[model samples]
Structures are given as C-alpha cells and as structure tokens.
Target: MKKISIIFILFLCISISFEAKSQSFVGLRGGINIPSVNYTNFVRGPIVTGFRNEFFIAPSFGVSYRNMQSEKIGVQIDLNYSTKGWGQLTLLETNTFITRINYLELPFYLHWQLIGKKKLKFFVDAGVYVAWALSAEQEIANDVDLVENQIIYSVEKDNRGDFGIYAGAGVSYDFSIFILQLDGNFKSGFANILPVNPFIKENPPISTNQVPSVQLSVLFPISKD
Candidate 1:
C-alpha cells in the first residue's frame, strides 16, 4: 500500500510539470501586407472616383505573447505595424489631377484561438488602430502642354490623423522553432479630417472610410523548452 501511494504522487508531479510548460509561449512575426482603401467621396463622373484604385504592398513586423487556458482556447496579444493608402483623380479639359494619401499605422489586437490543438490552429482578432498620415503627394498633367506638374500636399489643421476599428481572422501552423500565419483584416474610420475647397464651407465632404488588408507572417519563438 505504501509503494502504490508513492508511485501515484510521482505521476501527479510529472503531469503538472508538463501542463505548465504547455501554458505559455512567445513569438516574433514579420510579413508583407497588400492593402486597399475605400473612401467616401469616390464618385464616377468628370472627376475620377475611388481613393486611388491602385493596390500597394508594404512590410510588417510584430511580436506575440500567448497563454493557453485549455486544449481548445487561448489568449494572445500582438503589436504590429500596418500601412494603408488611397488616391484621387481629377480630369480637366486641359489638365488631369492625381492625389495620394499614405499612412503608417500602429495597431493592437486581442487574439482568440478557435481551435488550439494539433499542428494547425485557427483564430480571430479584433482591435483599434491609431494612424498618422506620413505623407501626401500629387501630380498634374496637362493635355496640351505635354508636361506633368508634381506637387506634394502639406497637411495643416485638417490632417489631425485618423482613428479606426479593426477586425480579422487567421490561421497559424506551429513548427518547433518558428510558426507561419496568414490573416485578413478590415478597418473603418469613425472620424475624419477631410481637405477643404474654398467654395465649400465644410471641409472633408466625406465622413467615414474603410480599408481592407491581407498579411502573411513568419514567426520565431524567443523562449525554448
């Protein structure tokens, strides 16, 4: 009877140790993002519409901390850099107008794992983003002159930056030392600092806007078992 009790206690200790090891993980992630922006003023007419229909790719980097509560659920926090933009076009009888807005953004999201076991895990994330308009540039081309005029727009009071909400879903594959993730996310702005035309008393004719983005990241774990 004494021997049996000692063996049982030893087995319990081993189980607890294994459980603690599986509870925590830390990793680093870096990826490329293909981003698209939707603007409020995009209308088809004499003026070219939509915030620059062109799609651009940017680089992203992030760090993640995850705590697993059970086999099927976990909590994760990630800090990442995201880039977005849009363009505008104006067609004049004599000249054509093009305007572009670029942003460098920082986002924080809460991650939830939908399926936590096995080599593949699926998850969803939601969060907020604070973005700064890093730069704005414009170009004008004259039909008759055969010359293009280039100018960079300067932001004043109206360029107070932008705030928005973001949500996304992704899947991740775990390897011994690294992990791979693929995700898609969208953001919607609640406020705006639209540019003003002298003829219009109210600036930023459009109020709300949206941006959609897709990302692929390679993550490396900092902690080793």
Candidate 2:
C-alpha cells in the first residue's frame, strides 16, 4: 500500500511539472458501473450451492488531470472513488446476498486520438491503476426463512490493496471553453481480493473483480501562461 501511494504521488508531481509546457485540462467525471466478481478454483460450500452470482450496479466518480503532448497523443491521471461487488440469488430459497466494496483508486492512462482533429474527436485509452480498499459490506435477505435481514461488515476476507489494467474508447467535443466527453471503459483486476479460503485445502480460491462502466466528463483547459 505504501509503495502504491508513493508511485501515485510521483506521477502527480511529474504531471504537474509538465502542465506549464503542455496543453492540460482539469475535469470532473462521474459514471455508473456494472461490477462482478470471478471466483475460480474454489470448493463450493453448501451455502453457495443454490445461489448464482451476478453483476451489481455501482457508482464511480472522480477528478482527472490530462496533458496533451501533441495533437494525437496525451496522458491522463485520475483520482476516483469507486464501488465494486457482486450479487447472489437463489430463487427456490428466495434468498439474496450482496457485497459492496468501496475503493480509492488512482489510474494513469495513455490516450490516442483515433479520428478527427478539431471540435469533435474519437479516442482510445489504455491504463493501469492502483487502489486501496476503504470498506466492505455484505447484506443478507431471505423471504423463505424466518431470520431477519442482516448487514455485515467484514475485513477478514478482503485484501486491502488492489491493482488492475483497463481500456477505454470515447468521443470528445470541444466547445472552445470546456470539453464534454463520453466514454465506455472496462477494468480487470489482477489481485485476488479473497486471498484465503479454508474450504480449498491445496490452493486458495482466486476471486477478482471485473467492472465495466459508462462515464461522462467536463473538462476546462489549463493555460500555459
């Protein structure tokens, strides 16, 4: 976690230093995410037998700094508050389980302009990110059982730090003052959030988060002067 923080800070410093020479923009972005977890190499417990895992809807918002090095090339960094998780449902038992994990994330991207040069343009970006877990919660609700609905917070099963790679494509319209951007992005985490599983004796279950999102941003240009 310390190393991740250091790297992010260093990137911010470097980006700020280039702001004087390059074309830069500061922006606010917000989005909706469809998040899911992939669990593999696991020994399924009795509690998991009847449930099917599905994607959960979540929110993502952030501030971004972008520096354009040239007409077709740029770099961007974002600081975001994001949520990711999965949902499980069992129809016969009328039971549902949902997990929500909050994270503070820093992502850096290299952007490539694909089409157009003036007011309207199409672009693509590929990036890597580091994130720290803020909190995690799970909810349990059942209609068939007499037990009351419950919400539980657990850190025992969570890995506090995560890293991932992502890619995106979007269109941007420059209004001479502020740029309005719309993008679709997909993220795939490499770190297994659930690092320990008692059910599997030889190997631990690999559980990673996958999220796809649509985002909108409004950016104001920064003057070199």
Cα displacement (angstroms), candidate 1, residue 97, comes to 6.2
What lDDT, from 0 to 1, does candidate 1 have? 0.56
Please write out the lDDT profile of model 1 over residues 1-225, one tens digit for every residue.
335434544543454444443455666666665543444443332353323233445556666675554555444555665444443333233444444455656554456678767779898876666677766655554443433221224555446477677688999888867778888877776545466465643333554446666767666655433
TM-scores across all candidates? 0.60, 0.80
Model 2 misplacement above 4 A: 1-21, 44-51, 91-93, 144-153, 197-204
Cand. 2 TM to true fold: 0.80
Worst 10 residues of 2 by lDDT: 144-153
Model 2: lDDT of residue 219: 92
Write candidate 2's Cα lDDT for 12-80 as tens digits. 456546544468899999999898776543334333322356566899999999888767777888999
